[model samples]
Target: MASVNEESVRKIIQYVGGKNNIKAGTHCVTRLRLVLDDESKVDKENLDKVDLVKGFFSANGQFQVVIGQGTVDKVYDVFIRLTGLGEATKQEVKDVAAEKGNWLQRGIKVLADIFIPILPAIVTAGLLMGINNILANPGIFFKNQSIVQVYPQWDGFANIIFVIANAAFTFLPVLIGWSAVRRFGGSPLLGIVLGLILVHPDLQNAYGLAQARSEGTVPVWNLFGLEVEKVGYQGQVLPVLFASYVLAKIDVFLRRHVPDNFQLLVVGPVALLVTGFLAFLFIGPVTMILANWITEGLVGLFDIAPIIGGAVYGFLYSILVITGMHHLFLAVDLQLIGSTNSTFLWPILALCNIAQGTAAFAIFFVARQAKMKGLALTSSISAWLGVTEPAIFGVNLRYRYPFFASIISAGIGGAFISVLGVKATSIGIGGLPGILSIIPQYWGAFAIGMAIVLVLPFLLTWVFSKFSKKKTEAELQ
Candidate 1:
């Protein structure tokens, strides 16, 4: 590991308007997140020029500087030392930054904070699902049968792989519960227990309840004369999030009021009982309904006009990325894949990512400065690998026109893919490698759509760059 760079940390503080300007600071996997007292004081141009700073953006009221993976911690250490503020946890920093947002923004930030920690697990599971899809695809290897079907002897092996791939999503509520309670400064074990209760074996599996509800055969439990649905919260995001928040509050309150001698035994049991009842009686049902509606609404709109929906989504997706709210769609994407076995949104997202990468590549050729060209090349590669923060903030957005050019190109490519009905069977990455997640039947369409995304943005940005250069020269003459 590299040691903390004190000089770089000093420049970061100065460029961000000094330690006094930052109310709170913390680092995540790849960025330094700071709640700034005055946004106007930030010297973005100078900040970007700082050594080791990849890019910067303000989202959800936090001024974020991208430090890349692994290096963020070292920089964060120096930052804490320089600011004289004690080291803060990621959740604490999120809380401070969240304080500046309106109700909706704060709500989204809370979700992001809760989910971000567990994204690596979800993403890894998604990639494994993609691999499993290939293994199960009949057209890929065997003639008229999947690999598992063709080789009965290998069935057990395939099933084990499937279980490993499915574990994260199948018990997602537990992960969310654990993370959410910790974020709220409560006992994680109790949160995990609450999560287990939500997804107990005796309860009806959430996925199956959809079918059961349609058949009018869904089971119900009588809890103190109240009829409660016996549904497991498997793969659920919102319900567990709400339940954990309620649990944390109840736990904290009980500890404060309970006698010290009896606190250990009384607080845990009472908090769990009350929180569980509330979760089942109100919070779980309400949030699940909201999650279902949001999922159905997006699916419904896409069904209404696939091409238009794809175009609109691709055009606006980068904006969501800029605001750090893109994680909001992870649950929806997972749900769509879990229910329908495919998602149109993932294909469109792939094109949008490729389009941004292509725009950055064009900037590489057009840039007058060698340093700009190097940044463009590296950021473009990063974007192609499904990480677009570098390309968007470091290169394309910095150039202004390249950003718009990429958006337009992405919209057109997204519409093309939508018209072709390209659907991904899984959701792992979102660029060149993302094609691995697409259904085998739509692989050809995905390739063609990606080609258009790659070329069109490069051509459009290159042309715009030439015109801008000529105009500048003419103005000087």
Candidate 2:
């Protein structure tokens, strides 16, 4: 790694009440995530003036100083070396930081940590799925004929596209299991094997079982005369998560009890067999039912009254972001996609991203300070790209009006889209690019919702700022 000014970083320790106050510390791509003995001890004013400091915020019990891209790692190295604190991973720091947070906060942070790393694969597949939809769905290209229907030659091409796009969803358990188990401190490779067992080809497909079981025609294994259903998890989330957790715990427990000399031969196979049997026998069936209930409940909730549901979720989304609880919704979005083949909730989430982006964009035009303007512009662009924390915490929350304006605009926009019955094919990028994830037929509705969120937030925030110049100034100080 590169190095930064040692003195500048040392000054940070002084400003935050010396090295003793830091319980744990780590860095991500752009920020120093620190668990502190006392946040009040931080010299907020002087610390903000430190070299390479972009901004600072306390979230999920970590006093995070935004040190900007390509620079934070450098600063973090100096921080660890100067403070005599051993370097730690972001997860370790987060675990230490959990002491200061409630269970909800800690849980949200853990989920975010696990999912964020695996998002690239899901997002890429989603974007491709959208393209496949545009090509395969009728009415967009021809009045009554899809691209594949009219040009039969394109059938094989569309099939290949479908295969590629469907692979991620079909094997979602593998991704979730690997990531979740690793996060839970188990061997990741073992997680992959466990995932394979959950989705084994010998088992009846989970999606097929739902209909077959309803008709009492589902297959069973009859292992040891216990008569276990031979259903694969496929795209299921909760089951894989539970199974992975059990796997991790079992691995840790056995490692402590087993001899080190026989560890290599004993651990992997024993853990896999025990976990697989337990999962199919108890954990998988129970969690699968639970997962089904949650999926149906959320989908049914929206189906019963989509406009109200959309409006409620939209309005509260940014507030959840502020409280660090929004990460919990990611599982909901994923489960909906797995069960229903699409998610109505994500379209509204995309619009919410637009609202935050546009709200921050408004500040660029309204603010005078070059520093604030720069942050407003950059963070707004970031929000549009689906990372809204910067815009929310850096610009909108600071101005106050922008944050409130965004939720209101998002609520209205979400209601409109819900009325239009917009849905996403998969989890794609959020904000403007997120429109690509919408079902081809609902494109127009999503566009209109996008317009509503894009225009309203900026207009509302600007108007709010105009009426309260003194409040804005006082808050800025």
Candidate 3:
């Protein structure tokens, strides 16, 4: 990719139907945003295989090719030269794309806007937790032993890593509160304060409430003759999101109505006091009940019919990624991990990723085109490493059969793993190395699930490709 040159640019042009198919062209920080006259004319199989081309996806009406940040501009320069297409601004492309999404897609994009900013924190914590899981757990690293179990002296080191990673999960509500409120144009500092109150030390720890309740030690604040349980909202998602929405509205209304001279005095303190009081007295209790209902409903469904649950989720997860609805699940996954110490959904996500990657891998052996073969191989490897966009948009979805083969394979594997009760200790990388994040005892079950995904995608894709008349005719041509 570092050595990408004019030849690479020309190759990209060739893959996108020799530039004539392009209606408008532009570059973003990391993507080539092109509106194509006829989207199907672009050769997706070859596009991803183009030197330095990372991935491509058709969103709204734009066929966007992701070609890394530093490299994309260079590629776009050559693209402009070779195609003789008039340059379009990135915003022009966005406006065009923006005009095309449905209400659901637009809604999910808003969720994406809220979650994407916080991803680095969550992803880092998830990865660190995976490393710490290996170090702290028995039966993972050294044949039924942990680093602490053997060294004993290194216990603090492992515990320290856990402490670091667990901090993120423990205060997940705060992170969401800040991000969500900011997205809604509220004071982010106030969001942080509101979030802090949800996890205040005076309240009974949310996770420890059951034990505290059993011991009759749960704290309560008595107001007149009434009593309110002093319960904290640790890693709860819905409560924070709902409360943040209310906070944003309150801040906006106060700003509009309050007099400028007294606004500083009235707005900040009033907003803080009202939002905090309402969040604690009403919003907290209501949303916490609603959130628990949702959490328990999902848990009950999966527990009652894990195989059916897994199969349905696995089949749709990659599709969710395409629609960008998957961001919503990150919040849910964190909530589950916080409340239950594990999530059943993330393991299925890993399997779906593997299925997508392996499906693209099957294209390597089946295709005759050097470009398609190369792209398939690279994207597949990228998918195995946890980034599935390349394999999905670059190779599998382009080939149609490979994409279908993958999801079906994922469905099968998901059912198997779910039936076996495979679960993740924390959200982490979502492919082969994802095994490192699995609860150690479920490692064998996950492996068996992987075998199903690996073998099925390859076999199914190979068979399906045999019937691909278009690819076959293209190869013969």
Question: What overall lDDT goes with each candidate model?
Answer: 0.82, 0.87, 0.83
Q: Tell me how candidate 3 scores on lDDT.
A: 0.83
Q: What local lDDT does model 1 show for residue 219?
A: 84
- Give TM-scores for every candidate, taking all chains together and pairing residue i with residue i: 0.87, 0.93, 0.85
Per-residue C-alpha lDDT of model 2 across residues 363-431, encoded as one tens digit per residue: 888877666777788889989999888888878887688999999999999988987789997995798
**Model 1 regions more than 4 Å off:** 1-13, 24-34, 44-55, 64-92, 214-216, 223-226, 338-341, 470-477
The best candidate by lDDT is 2
Q: Give the worst 10-residue stretch by lDDT in candidate 1.
A: 468-477
Candidate 1 lDDT tens digits, 356-377: 9999999888876655667688
Pairs of residues clashing in candidate 2: none
Top candidate when judged by TM-score against the true structure? 2
Question: lDDT per residue, candidate 3, 308-409, as tens digits?
Answer: 999999999999888778877887787788678889999999999999999999988887766667768878887887888778887787768899999999
Error of 3 at 88 (Å): 11
